[model samples]
Target: MAGRESLPLRRLKLFQPLNRLTDDQLILLASRAERRTHSPGQKVVERGVRDGMDYFLVAGTVELKAGDGRTSKIEAGGEKALTAVARLQPRMYDVVAVASCDFLVVEQDILNQMLRDAPLIQADLDSMVDETSGGTDEHRLLMEFYAELRSNQVSLPSVPDVAWKVRRTADRENSTAEEVASAITADPSIAAKLVRACNSPLYRGFNDVRNVREAVIRLGTRTTRQLVTVFAMREVFSTKQPFLQKSIDALWKHSREVAALSWVLADRATRIDPDEALLAGLLHDIGAVPVLVHAEHYARLFADANLLDHALGELKSDVGAAILEAWSFPATFVEVARHAEDWQYECRQDLPQLVDVVQVAQLHAMIAAQQNADLPQFEDVPAYRRLGGLELNASRSLQMLTEARARVDEVHRLLAIH
Candidate 1:
């Protein structure tokens, strides 16, 4: 039997969703996960079969074939192999070993259950902290908070009604810009902001637009939907507790910067819609909101910044994914929320994805803020390479950002909450 110590936990952390797990949860996962091997030409997974398992390539190579004859290769130790081979259930592809291959096989149910129980596990661990040693009782407080979060007692923020209405109006078959404009008008503040944004350098035209209806017509329904959501996102970052306001403000600022960078990168380097990329960047760190909300109940945790940061770092990705999922966001935005921080994450697609744009944008934001000391080299990041035309050296990357400073500030000013 494979024990926790026998599993390659470090390498496993490179995988998505798994990268979001807490250290204790990873230990539990390692114990249940098993190692397997396949000889060259062996079938690793069959198309259209429900195997109830996820296969992570650990060594050698495998080829994934679709019914239509489309194929792709994943090589061990490469960024592409960091995620499961054909992750969808009732497998979308038939995976065959191209060389002798080593794999880490995790039962899907076990992994799901572990993820579901993560908050409870953290709560239990915090409950064990000794309180009599004059230490802060944040552990006990957090344990209670985590228990509430696990039980859904802690309310996750709802998608603002105006944003939801705009999405619904835009997504309806045959919906017009006029109908979407009506949705925006329900929240006059967002309506005004949308019109104002349309005039900003990010979307400026030869002539200025004066109203929500004209703004919607100029921006198109899809861009209007996204901008409405972006404009409304500020309300989600609020905190009633004065002590937590600074952290909330900082998070909002960081998200705006990343959103701005994502917009510029997508507009310049990829075919992805700049507005969609902007939305992805804005919501990437939204998971931190619930964590901060919970922490407000335990004011002492604020005194120990590391403890709060650790909690936010460990829990935000999963929480953000859940929040977006509940809001009916497309899979791409949900993916950005879940894996944008997975610096080594590589998409299966040949082209850059919204997540890739947001990831590179985040790195740029960090670099600009002088927080790149611990980040991966720009040239080595898979997302950076996928971006193609951009120069990847630190000086060159900084130069690109420098060139875009005016546009970035325009976006930031457009989206920043007053």
Candidate 2:
């Protein structure tokens, strides 16, 4: 087969999103993309490699062979060529060049960052998606879940009565540390956890405070209430499905890290309350719990993590907001859970709120996860700006970062990560 001429950057069908990129952005992406040429019959990428690359066929054709032996040929400039199999861990398929071909490979992380920063790229992808199924099965499921939540048919998760009393006491204008402690004492398990948390390195006082009221006074009423509520949250993370256990554990782990980071970052901004930020971070991804719970009924969706992740990404925020409201949380925390993924969101305030702190903290968590990768610098993230111009390596930021890192064990204990 004859090779076709190369298309301009803006005209390449495999890169419709690139059309919206500024010249500088396009140049930067081109610099990062690894270009390669392959002859006919050459395998482009093998399955299960975890290369994390999205391949774009710039010229000629390639045959995609699924793990199940199904095959489809995608040609350059073809409508189907726009998207690679999205970040399918364990590599869902293998691409083999069917003719002399040119390819551009971009890392999945880099592309995701671009999509996050550029609404234009998202809009372009949405348009392409609209060409296919108007309402995806996963989306339909999310809609049904929302309707059920609103109708009170799906029975939202509720904390134990003891936890509710602690929250109510803390919400009062004249509530004292003694009252908060008494409420926690009503639940022995929660009281024990609160004592342990008070002794933990994250908030350990100068000396041990054995009594519940003394511990509450030492940790402050607000902190005590937050801990009590989160203690109840730890119990709900459990599931009967053995396979789903790992997913639940991972969700709690991520939430713990986010919470720790949020608490540390909150101290830097006066307007943001560390206790509120901590709770917000802990529950930011709370929507995933119910989604996973319902998914247990659909074995196919429940088993395929990549598919579930896709659905969660699409619906978690909306479900999270609903969950928070049902729990009677304040509007600020509810909005934080609802807009957890919106890193660029800015509130009209003199200083940042819990949402802003959680956003930046989440970014830090992401950076820590990609320990060995050449991840984007904190400065590149737009959220870093909204966070009071915070820097990961600055003197004050570094101090907090060091403290947060050292308290990882405490976070693990709080979230029951073990």
Best TM-score among the predictions, by candidate number: 1
Model 1, residue 115: what's the lDDT?
54
Question: Which ranges of candidate 1 are over 4 A from the true structure?
Answer: 1-151, 389-395
lDDT by candidate, in order shown: 0.78, 0.67
Could you give candidate 2's per-residue lDDT for residues 231-282 as a string of tens digits? 8888777788898889899888889888888877786544577777878899
lDDT of 2 at 142: 37
Tens-digit lDDT track of model 1 for 223-329: 89899999889999988888778899999989999999998888777889988999999999998998888877776645567557756766787678767755657
TM-score (all chains, Cα) for each model: 0.69, 0.61
TM-score of 1: 0.69
- What residue runs in model 2 are displaced by over 4 Å at the alpha carbon? 1-153, 268-271, 371-382, 388-404, 414-418
